[model samples]
Target: MLLLASVMAHYTWLAIDNLDDVSLQIQAEQIAENLQLTDGAPTLRLPENLQRAYDQSSGSYLYALIDSKRNILIASEDKARDVFSALSAEQLQRPESYFRLINGDGSGAPYYVLQKTLVGRPDLHVVVAQGHLHSDVYIDTLLTEFASHIGWTLPIILIGTLLFSVWTIRTSLRPIKDLSDRARMIRPETRGLRLPTSEVSDEMLPLIQAINTALDRFEKGFEVQRRFTANAAHELRTPLALLTARLDQLEESATAQQLASDIERMSRLVAQLLLVSRLENTTPNLEPGVDLNVVGETVVALMAPLAIAQNKAIALRRASAPVTVLAMHHQLEDAVRNLIENAISHTPPGTEVDVWIGEDGSLAVRDHGPGVPADLRERIFERFWRGRERSGGAGLGLAIVAETMRAHGGRVSVEDAHDGGAVFTLHLQLDKSAL
Candidate 1:
């Protein structure tokens, strides 16, 4: 800022000096031209005709002439009475054609000197003197007075600009602040929250829409969880309560044993329910998560005793090799358990239930029993769906598997196996690194 101010001041001064120089040069030329008509040594005589003409004019120039050596020849008598000394030749040559000389007599008005070189006589110089260039001094005086008035007022303008900037920044961020507030209000208890979009800036509209979409998904999941809990309680609690009461009333006998069997069945149902409920909440806790092949084996171990009790042969076929995936432990186990259970229940006592892991991130559990009709195969995964004449189990196994697979970013389906048996296949997305 200081550099710029200095440049501005210097340029202004140069411009004003140039104006004076040009005026001085013009006056000097006119006077010299009139005086040199005799072609003698350069001289200046303010002729009467010229005097009268200039006297009526509205200006303050006093005409003069000078020799090339820079000596004054003629001066205005009114100017000479309060005259200042002659101007230096170098100063007279300024591009602006104006020169200032302070009066030695203390009475002369500040004056600008103008000199013009003679055309024919190289030794002659013509000049004029005019009133002090007063515009700059007048402006400076006005600013001095103006500064006194404005010194205390500048701080007010600065404070006003700062306050306005802060208000603008806050108002501009109001929508974002509101968005955060709405997000904070969303919870399991109040999951219906949707950020308002009516006043969103165009640049933030995508984020607003995405948040609303996420809220919609959250609401749906919460509803599903509520329904699952209610239905699971209704389905399992009744049989268990009845079985427990019967056990309490019975004595030791075949009838008592039958009650125990019923209790066991009820316990199995409750266990199945626990598996499904866990599945609903399971998600990968880490990136590049556990492999499904390992999950399938763990499930096979857990349910092997039940299969053996039913006189069903359970086996892993063809090196069900490592099936890599992104999965949470309990969720993948749920999907595997459902398929293995389906295989065990549907197969003949002697026929093997084969769980196969495929090369393409797929798992299949096949049972060599009467297969599902093609029409019903797709519906097998629907909650509580049971085939005609299907029995001995609640119809939730396949549905639970489907739900678990879907939650883990995968899917489950049923189709005919190579051996004309029903095969349930669960497929899950694998991380690229796992593959």
Candidate 2:
């Protein structure tokens, strides 16, 4: 708006200035047209309207007729005579000039003067002058009126345009915002999730469709991978069971016992692989809450025999009040079981592995062995990532635990215990309603 106003003002000034010059030129031409030679003397016989426009009493418009000798032949007023006669020969030779008469009865006011040679009477010239004060008053009044009527509305118009632009942008991009919100909900567990294109604008439709197509390919590939894992695990279970049974028939020697342990670890690995595939393929139900104390008790009881055989005891410390969390029952139990098994495997023979269920929806398993190094804490939860000690079991237990907690919107972390060893803690979202 400011630029528009500036441009308009500049052009308007040029037009007004040109109009002034054109007006002076027209008056001079009119006087020349009225020039008549009477007995070899040039006389200006202006019409009544022209006579009134150049009225002597007005003192705003004046004209003079001069001979080649610089003698004034006729003038509208005595001031016109003084204004034109005082001009230098160089100025009179020019077509147009400005003059400010400072002599008697001239008022010392500035005037724009035009000198034109009389047609067919080259020896005679007509000089016309208009007061600069009059033109200045006219220009100022016109500009003032324009500012009063039009200029003040520019700000209002600019503000209204800005508001309208903001509203238009927000309305146009509303669908994109909705699409962004829905895109955030896509996760590995959420299969067949795609962004909708019904509400999107034409400009954004292609991009959204491309993203959906990419998601389709990714989901298909993920499904293939998950199916492969599940099928392989299922196929291995039967052979592994048959092998275990065959080994059990003659497993009374130390070598046979060691083979049985290997078989057992292989079976555990296959089961965990199946569990991981299931976790990826299915979304766990989190409607009702699960009690951490109950899960801890059940898993501890199930693993008690193994812990005793290893000469390491397992202890569960339940919270005073029930600590309920939003999780699937089987998945929550699996996560707790993995933590307990990891603690038992790492703990020293004579020391006990402590399992604590806190009131804050936390399950902590503390061992009595060397703690996990700070550098490897985060990597320990990755699939197939074993510690430097390289425990005999496959490195899928902690990875499965991490995946379970992630699916349930929970997190698992490992920290140093008070006395020694690493404390693996699961922090889940508490079920306030259940509490």
Candidate 3:
């Protein structure tokens, strides 16, 4: 736009200058037509209007007549005579009408000179001079005023365009923003849900549809996996019960006792795997609040007999005040029970396994036995993982605890206890505001 404006201004200036030149040519020709060469002394037969204009003595108009010998014959003003006298002989020899611009050196107003050779009088000529400062001032003034207005108008137009561009860009991207927000809400439970396609832009529709299709495949795969695990666990239950009954008939023997223990361990492993499958396929049930202190005390009590049978003791170090957490009762209890069972297994005979419920809603199970090595602490939570030196049970206890914690949006960590034993801590969401 600026380039276009500059081009327009340049052409307009040229047109104005050309028009002024045409006006000067016409004036000089009119002056030449009114000349009379009587007795070889040139005289101007001025019309009433032309005589009045030349004799007006205004700064804008002037006229001078020059003889064949290059001597000034008549001049409307002394300044005109002086300017004509100053022109070189060669400058005065033009065959056609011409105009010249002169600069004022502060002595008088700057002016333009128009000269024309007389038609019949061969050597006679007429020259018309006018003050440009008076005649051409309006044109220069108008151009400057117009250019100044353009200067202000262009910026306003550009700024308005800039603001409109920003609004347009943001408005155009609104659909993508909505798509991102909807994508974040998808979890395993909500995986079957689809993104709304009504308002999606045509340009983005293909990508969004591709993502929805991928999600469909993922949900189907997850359903197949969950069904397989649940069905296999269910099918094994009755046969395992019959096997237990058969083993019970001869369980008084050492071989029968060992078979029973192995069968029980296998049953626990199936239950743990089933729990993992179910937890992964669904969201945690957190409608009813459960107190971690109550859950911890219950799990400690349940594991107390097993600990005592191994010549180990289980104790609950409850918090001073109840620590309420946002978790389902059974799931919370399962997590705490697994931790206690793990502690008791690792603890030696005559040692105590401590279950501590913190006021901040964290549960810690400490065993006074060899602490888990730093490098193996995280690995111990993998399914079917056991320490290098450990034996006698399925290795899903810690893994079950980890999965249960995940279902509750909680965390489980193992660190060295003060007694040089391993301490497993379960960090839960503390519903202090509810309490």
Candidate 4:
């Protein structure tokens, strides 16, 4: 970075040098314009300031007039080969208009040579040479004094610029930094915690919103798990207690039959609640391309006995070809079984329950029972909203199915059966090529 600053300084110095040089050249041009070269008369009469300047200076000015043929018409010191005539003709008629003549006196001598027309002869030329050791000896002394001045000046300017740049960058990023700190301080225990939305940076606002959305989902999951766990423990406890009490009362030949049935029913309800909770928390990572046809076959085989106990017939209708989808095979099969069982439990004896697997990765279950009310259709998918008002099986069966479909980027809904029964539809995101 300092190197970059130096490059900038170099360009700045070039501009200063050019400006100063131009000013010096314009001053010399003005002096040349003012000098008059009259015929047979002296052209330049020195001004008061000029004469005073020459007197105080430790160096003298030498003037000479030379003709076109190289004959010297006039010389400043013609007395006896004075110090001014020391230069050869080649040196006098140099090619360049302005030249610095150095070491003409003794060691360290320097002079500035400017050519002008001689007085009294416009065709004749005169060369005026003046000593210049950096323009003035006194000026050279001031240059050293300014050395220490620049030594402090540049660093002070650099330090100030660096401080300002730091402040600017910090000010621009402060909002995001504060956001990061606040978010970091929050933990899982603080489920309702949120970032300060008002002080958010516009650039980071979308990211913050997305994080808050995720937090909302996490909080919802926490509440559901907490509720489901508490309710499941409470609902299962009484049946288990009854079964234990009934089993304990059974003497040598006494009936223990009711205890066995109660245990079985209680086990089923507990299993259903656990499955619902698992589905609700299922992440996309847990689901994959599982064959729906095979899953359906498995669930149907498992539930046929339960259907028979309810005096209902379980039917599976699927194409001969395989149907595949991205889904949790067991969870999806469990959901379908819940819907089928609920339908079978509600319908009269001998009524057929059909589970159809379509070629489009669609699963539909329909039962010949009184259909659900339109108003309660939405509530049917909600946990614990058993519309005993229609047909009820702990009311969590369809809710679990809906949650499973969501985890797999699929959907589940209830619609009117074409044959006048309640139909549950589960559509999964399937790779159509698998058909």
Candidate 5:
């Protein structure tokens, strides 16, 4: 737009200059036609208007008639001398009629000089000059007025176009945002649902269809995995129960004790794997408010006997007020129990494991044992991944805790305690009040 305005300005200036020059040319020719030759000497036969224009002292028009031998025949006062002196000697010697722009009267002001020799009197020349200062002022004034108008109009047009573009772009992208919102709502159970393509653009349809195809493949794969895990876990339970019964009937010897421990470990792993499979296939019930303080106390109580058996003490701390969170009671209990058991398993003999429940609906379990390394903290939550120094029942304790927390829109994080052991914190959104 600026470039366009610049072009317009330049062309307007050229056009005005061309028109003024042509008008000056016509005026010069008219003056030449009015000249009368008598006895081979040129005499001016001025029109009424021309005579009046020459009589003014501050007139912009000036003319002169010079004959052979450089004698002036008729001139407008001393104006003729100013024109003659303003020209170069070579310019004065020219016989052809031509227009020249030059500064005359020694004033440094530009004038248009039209010099011509008479038709029959070749040696007799007539020179006409007009001040260009007023014409220049007129052109400048016109451009200034044009620029002022364009300055306001162009910005308004640009601003309107910018606003229109923003609205159009935002409106055009709304369908993509809707598609993303729908994708976010898709979970294992909701995987059957598909994204709507009715509002999609032709340019984006291919990509959207490809995503839906991938989702279909993922849903089929996930269903197969869920079924296999459920079946394997279910199949292991019968033999595990039979083995436990056999171990119980013959358990007074060292071999029997070792076998019992192995059985217990296998049993716990089977239970955790089943829980993970269930969690993967279905969303947890979140319609109930469970007091985290109660959950923490219950888990501590359940693990107290095991900690005592290992020569370690389990302690509980609770806030004055109940810390209620949006979660299913059994699922929340399972998560808290896993954290307590994990702490008891890691702590050394004679050391205490602490379970803290806060009014902010948060729970923490800390063990007085070797803290996890910084790099391994996050990896501990992955299923079947354990620290090199750790011994556990298939490393599913923290994984179950992590999955449970995720189901409740909560998070579990492990950090080093100030007193040198590892502390695992569970952060959950507090249920302010039950509906």
Candidate 6:
């Protein structure tokens, strides 16, 4: 807009200047036409209107008649006479017709002067000059009005346009933002989750549909994997139970005891596989509040015999007050049981594994063995990711504990124990209703 205004002002100025020049040229030609050669001496004849217009003492218009010898024959005013007399010899010898802008009468006001020689009497020259103060004032007033109008309106127009553009962009992208939020809710346990297509624009629809299709394939593959794990564990349970019965009948030998231990580990692995399948296929109901102290005590009691057999001991340290948390009962108990079993297996023969329940709905299992390495702590809870010190059992125990905590919206972490061992902690959401 500013550029447009500048261009318009420039053209306006040029147009006004051209019009003034033309008017000056026509006036000079009229004065020249009135020049008559009477008795071989040129004389200017002017009409009444032209004579009256130039005769004013302070008029903006003036005219003069001069001869080829640079002598003024007649002038409308003394200022015009002075202007003609002061011209340089070279200026007086200009072409037959010419125009010039000059500061005449030494008054700092500009004049448009047109000089023309008579067609028949070349010896006589007619000069018309108009003062430019009034015209300049008019042009300046016009430009000032235009600039003032634009200055006030342009900023308002720009601010309104900017605000409108922001609103339009945000409104147009609202559906995509909603789609992003919905995509974040998708997980392996959350089946049939897809971005809704109803409000999405056509440009984004194809990408959203493609993502949903990929999720469909992934969910189907995950379902198949879950079914296979569940079925395989179910199929192994009966044979393992029958084999245990048969082995008990021919037991009481060194080789038989080692084989029994191996069978127990395999049974535990099968149970964990079944648990993993169950956890993947469905979300556990964690609305029920369970006492963390009770769960810890029960798991400690169940695993005490195994700890004693391994020449280690297991003990439960209950909280001063009941530490209740939101959880599924069986799932929480199984998670604590895995932690206890893990602690007993890892700790030294003479050391004791402690299951501590905190008043803040937290439970920790500490073992007096080489703590998990700092880099491997997070990976230790991944499915089948046994580190260099792989325990005899399949690496599903810690993974199950992690899955259980995730189902309950809880957290599990392993950190260095103060007494130089590993401490595995479960941080669960406290049940305010139970409190």
How high is each candidate's TM-score? 0.46, 0.70, 0.64, 0.47, 0.66, 0.70
Model 1 residue-pair collision total: 4
Q: Candidate 3: which pairs clash?
A: none
Task: Quote the RMSD, in angstroms, for model 6.
Answer: 10.9
Model 1, 75-137: lDDT tens digits are 665553244344676754533345565555655466666556666655655557777646865
lDDT comparing candidate 6 with the true structure? 0.81
Question: Cα RMSD (Å) between model 3 and the true structure?
Answer: 10.8
Clashing pairs in 1: 18-96, 21-96, 21-97, 21-98
Please estimate how well model 2 matches the true structure, expressed as its whole-model Cα lDDT. 0.83
Q: Which stretches in model 2 have alpha-carbon errors above 4 Å?
A: 1-174, 287-289
The residue-by-residue lDDT of candidate 3 on 83-103, one tens digit each, is: 677655765688654556453
When summed lDDT is taken over every stretch of 10 residues in candidate 6, the lowest stretch is 96-105
Candidate 4 Cα misplacement greater than 4 A, ranges:
1-265, 286-289, 389-392, 432-435
Residue 143 displacement in candidate 6 (angstroms): 6.4
Measured with C-alpha atoms, the lDDT of residue 192 in candidate 2 is 70
Model 2, 393-424: lDDT tens per residue?
68899999999988988899999987899999
RMSD of each: 14.2, 10.5, 10.8, 14.2, 10.0, 10.9
Task: Give lDDT tens digits, candidate 5, residues 1-435.
Answer: 666578677867775766556655666677788887677656677789778866773647777777655566777767567556655545557775455545444565666777777777677777777765566666785667567755567777788878989999999999989998998999765778888878789998999899899999999998898899889999999999999998788849999998988888888988988988877876667855688878877878888999999999999998888777888788778888888888888888999999888777789899987888998988999988877435655888898889888888889999999988999999988887852
**Candidate 6: TM-score?**
0.70
| Segments of candidate 3 deviating more than 4 angstroms | 1-178, 251-254, 281-283, 372-395, 432-434
For model 1, the superposed segments whose C-alpha errors exceed 4 Å read 1-254, 281-289, 318-321
For model 1, the local distance difference test gives 0.69
Between 3 and 4, whose lDDT is larger? 3
Quote the lDDT for 105 in model 4. 47
Residue 283 error for model 2, in Å? 2.4
